[model samples]
Target: MVATFGEVVYESSRAFADDEEEECEAQTGLSFEVEHTSVAKSLLEKGSPAAGLVFCAFVGKVAVGFGDGFVNNKSGFDLLAEVCMVGQGENVVDIYLNRPKKKVVAQLYYGAKDKNNPVIFALFNTHGVPRFLANEIVSKVTEFIEVSNRILIFHSDTLAYYQSDERCEGKVFYVASSKYSRANIPSTAVPLAPPNVIGGIGAGVLMHGEMMDKPALLLANYGENELVDSISLQPFAAIVKQGAPDPSSFSLSQIFKQLELTISQSLKSNVNPVAISNLYI
Candidate 1:
């Protein structure tokens, strides 16, 4: 039988667990419960010829574009696509009906809590999703999930940073001065890092050497007067620092290794799992 809109799917967070033991425990990370129930069907059935899907998992938001149609065997990528399209936009909806045989591109954002259990606003764009949809997904995500006062969305070529104010109902304002680059970085280089404030220190894949010659793991701040410090990196600084083996070279393995170390450190430090979910995987 085909699944319909508003049907809750119980997913095993075990697939996202750290080890065999954790997987065995089968912890429930985030429930794929349907939201925006009022317009799910119509949105799927008639919104647009081009379908865009959005969904949340443990506070993480993901969006994908697929061809319109009724979906069958909604497992793996298909299920993921459907979840992302729900309540995504007025132009796109009803991703499940007549689902496409394949997905176009999927954009993901990782959400996390700091040491104090406050939400961390961070978006990671693995796939090249459009800026408009990315913004829309993040906005809707904040509405459904508890979020921090600040927000940052990172893509290969662009970075969107925002600060929220309680006085303004947690509305976010974009930071136009933040700079980022992916030029000359290998497509294999995965950009993953804990989200830091717009003008603060953080670590991730940054351009090193002259003319953006190579992709090197570096520690740097986003804005002027911001120190390149490890205060934001905390427990993972020592290990991640090792990944940058001088500015003259780039190693895909080393980069991934550093990411793994960061994730392990995060788990050990009791960092919110949701925050580190997309960092390594």
Candidate 2:
């Protein structure tokens, strides 16, 4: 039951002028392997939600996310929190389930926006999932739901290249896996520096997409501290809202307010439902 993880001790984002691969330097990282032959079996057997692609987000500061509270409820099995510290040992985690309740193992949610809506099919990561389990959690979770060739990953982290503006006010940048993905990137985002690198779970997803020839976009919103509010989070909402079936129907502020509340509850109330998702629990 032991696991390996790439605990990222030191992460630096290098700057680049053109569209080159990111240059990452991590003092320590988490790495692990698991047997997941039946990982996606539930989604395959039970069916998955409808969506063009997954709009997954990784916000470093928001420990509590919209994905919280979706439990596995396996009778004797202990329910997991979305946020928890993981060491190199046998650990039980959640991943998939019925559509109305599946968000993820740490936070698998279903029936989210169950009504016939624009179909965001969103996935939220509290932050630094890899620090506890490296990208193993992400890699395993990807086995759950299926998506099209295109994937969009939104995350907040420190970008040394943008140290001038700072992570809180730092500009948004994007790194695409292929030329096609780059063309799809919105004009509002800047390109990460040539020598800079994008790390964490998003890095693994993007690289895998590149090798598979799948078009994927990794949008970075630089930030200095753990997320507390939705100050500079608008760009993520903007990109997502812009892609909705009816852009106007999607209220940017509403999502922000939700984000604000989630952060508020985590800080003020000291309750991170994210911890229940197990790995982080």
Candidate 3:
């Protein structure tokens, strides 16, 4: 039947065994029937309309799915996970620094970029985008950037250089900042001036540029270094150079496809959908 977020959580909680009961109760405020099972069942069967009202929120688009978290584990079934996408804040910057597909080892070909070099790339997909897409795009972009640069250096932080012309010598540091986007980074001045650690939304976008105010940096929220580590993995570096054109030109769908592949690969070789669903239940 239908269920509100709270009611859904409450029913899910009641379904758990004894030891787990208190934990869910404490966390979700879902307790056993002080009244009766039938009363709770009735409420769960007819959930509030408020749950349906909780759309995507930001873009105001109605969220996909019926507020239920279930998937068939098939081709298009991945879209069902959208329930977890709810209520995410912009505080976390999801970076996809992709490297090129079919990369050569330590050699920069004319058009073949280094798949390892950090570069922002976008992949297009016909389906809507998801978190998993980031992995593929990151791989492709990395390859393209490596081919373009002669001295390839990578660090978790920024680097600098001094430029001496006939007139004078000026120090230029590749400063990283969360304030800039790929579109606007071209206009940014070199030797990024102080106090800002390159990490965040703009930092991921900046990686695509020839010379960044700082090396590609991603400003992440505190206690989330795992996000940084996750992007560093191999699959995330496999960049998708080009994909089918998108109306918005974002190619987010391609990125999502790659991400899904990478994630599916990570979950054990054999995963039973029914068993997995049972775990969630």
Candidate 4:
């Protein structure tokens, strides 16, 4: 049978958890496949695509993934987690990045471009995990997020970010958020926060991380909002300082400018009507 492109990428990431067939399937399920395919397709014009790959720890989220939130005030960090051709990168997947066969959703080489100066971040919403996988919805809280070094950085409310805990999902360490007022964030921007359960994917990832004794961080927006500014990327600034080889070399502003340009173009392409009333954002 000819495996679909989505299946190929899913399988690639799936390879990270080669043993636990049942548990793995239960966690990822068809839902993950659907989103996986949807995301892969979004990057393709029509056929198979895969340039190179290195299966590092995967950075993922269910719906409210970082692919959305942190609007307006942007992060000038010029380093963008540019998506790559990983859907059908057979040679890359089988050789370069996976020769050791480490179990992970995959991660960036951090400074692959210029290891000496290491500026660009090699990951983010890599067009495989859907922004809103069905199983991660509020109605599907029972299911746990799959195993792997999957970091959960989705959107959240200012309340949750400041509170340092999720109401339904249990106690969680609040990481960070975009700076914004209570009112809803901009359209292109996203109002972060798991739609439910302290964050559906967020909770699951935390649980899985605990089991591995390596809890992934939940870097999220300070509030459920979006934007057209550079402040949105402030939270990641902390990460840059921590993980980047040469922290000072980066600037959230550059990232904000790049995203701002791309997003502006995207916005112009769509037809969005203005809201007549603003009672509760």
TM-scores of all candidate predictions against the true structure: 0.22, 0.31, 0.19, 0.25
What is the model-wide C-alpha lDDT for candidate 3?
A: 0.21
Q: Which portions of model 2 miss their true places by more than 4 Å?
A: 1-49, 59-132, 154-225, 244-281
The TM-score of candidate 1 is: 0.22
TM-score of model 4 (CA atoms) = 0.25
Model 1 residue 137 lDDT score: 38
Which tens-of-lDDT digit does each residue in 22-83 have in candidate 2?
A: 22223243232222223222222222222233344442223233323324321111111212
- Error at 200, model 1, angstroms: 4.5
- Over 1-281, each residue of candidate 4 has an lDDT whose tens digit, in order, gives 11211111112221112243333343433322112233332221121221111111222321122333435433212222222211232111110111122222222222233222222222223122222222232222111111111112222221211112333243232212223212322222222332222221122333333333442332221112221122223333334334432222334344334434443444475521111111011
**lDDT for each residue of candidate 3 in 1-281, tens digit (9 for 90 to 100):** 22211111112211112443242232321111111133222211222111110000000001111112323321111121121221112211122212222211111111013222212221111112222322233233332222221211122211100011121111111222222222222222122233122222111212222233433222221111111123212222333122112222323334435534544554565521111221110
Model 1, 81-119: lDDT tens digits are 232321233322221111112222222221112122111
- CA RMSD of all predictions: 20.5, 15.3, 25.1, 17.8
User: Residue 78 of candidate 4: its Cα lDDT?
Assistant: 22
Rank the candidate models, highest TM-score first: 2, 4, 1, 3
